[model samples]
Target: MVDLRLERVCEEASKLFISKGYARTQINYIANAAGISVGSIYTLFTSKKAIFDFVLKCIIDGNYMGNNMALPIKESDFASLDGEILNVCKELSENFEKHILDGDDSYDFKQMISDVFDIISRYGVAFLIFQSNGSDSGVLYAYYVQFRKLFCENVEKYVYNFMEKGEIRRCEFPEHHARLILETLSWWGMHVKYDAFETNTGISQDVSKNVAMDALLHAYTI
Candidate 1:
């Protein structure tokens, strides 16, 4: 029952935080949005920050591992390497377009990264604290962490494989390539589309993607 209430509150608060920036979203606003009283929220969360943190973690867990992460295709599993590579790229491109590039980020990328780390830590501690206690919290946390780890590891492997195959340029580091791909896409899509950056220069999404793709190919091929 507590978990259900937490999920509901977090979902509603997530909406509010995204629609209205975090600074402007007050506790009363969340309570109203959730169709609950201000006091009711306090029962579940000590403060509005607590609510925001939980909601932010949920968003990161959903976006990073749940959807955007890509897995590897084994050589034996695929009839042809070329076909498998293209398939992976297509899937990854679609996910990038939909989740990370679709809209203005509710929080900055750095904050999202930090929140993801926090959630991982919480999951780890939950296990240690509840081992042999058979608490449902421990079970749920462990399962969620494992599920997320699978996606994260798969995505990292996909990035490394693509680099190794010369599909993408050799990055200074493999992880750097993966992180930059995401960060560049998010910043380019949002700021370029909105002209929100200090610089007046803006690029279309197609051009932006092509530039990055071409630069990568050029760097890797020679």
Candidate 2:
């Protein structure tokens, strides 16, 4: 029972941090939002910083309650690498499509970029924390490194699938192409929330993706 309250406190604390920023968020704020006592929070977390650290770690580690941040997984039924990659891309594409199309009224392409940026800005707190604390905690640093490496692997798989399907122009350096796409997305993630740029929201996502596909096809598809 205490553990559950602690968990709720952590969740409320995270939302408050994202909504209000960390330094401004107080123990009373968390206690009120979580419907728990300030002393109880102290029992589970040594300090507000500790609670923030846990919240940041949880958000970046793919446990953020409001964000569907799961990594693309290959189905057990798909035995082949190509099949797995296709399934993963399809899933990713569907997610992006829904956001780009069926999201809240303002969720156009520009808003999509904004959303990506929002996710990055929120997650960056944890990443920054990890970077600062890396030397002190070998295990935590190693875990973050592992996730970063997996992110790269997933990018490569997606790029390879595009090449295989003739959706993109083939690059002599496929890895470089993969890196470019990943970096582009990361850039959007990092800067889009606070920096709203003039994106092509006038175009539909399908048309936008088609344009990207056409550009790649013209550049690499033989």
lDDT (CA) for every model shown?
0.46, 0.52
User: What lDDT is reached at residue 64 by model 2?
Assistant: 33
Task: Kindly report which residue pairs in candidate 1 clash with one another.
Answer: none
Lowest summed lDDT over 10 consecutive residues: which window, candidate 1? 69-78
In model 2, the clashing pairs are 169-216, 169-220, 169-221, 170-220
Q: Model 1 over residues 1-222: C-alpha lDDT tens digits?
A: 134456567666655554455566788898887778887777767666556445534443443223321122122322232333334334533543343344433433233333333333333222222232223222333544454444355445555655555555566777765565444444444334332335336555566555544554444443
- In order of appearance, the predictions have TM-scores of 0.32, 0.41
Q: Model 2 lDDT vs. the true structure?
A: 0.52
* Candidate of highest lDDT: 2
Worst 10 residues of 2 by lDDT: 69-78
TM-score of 1: 0.32
C-alpha RMSD of each candidate structure in angstroms: 16.7, 13.1
What are the runs in model 2 whose C-alpha is more than 4 Å off? 1-45, 57-124, 191-222
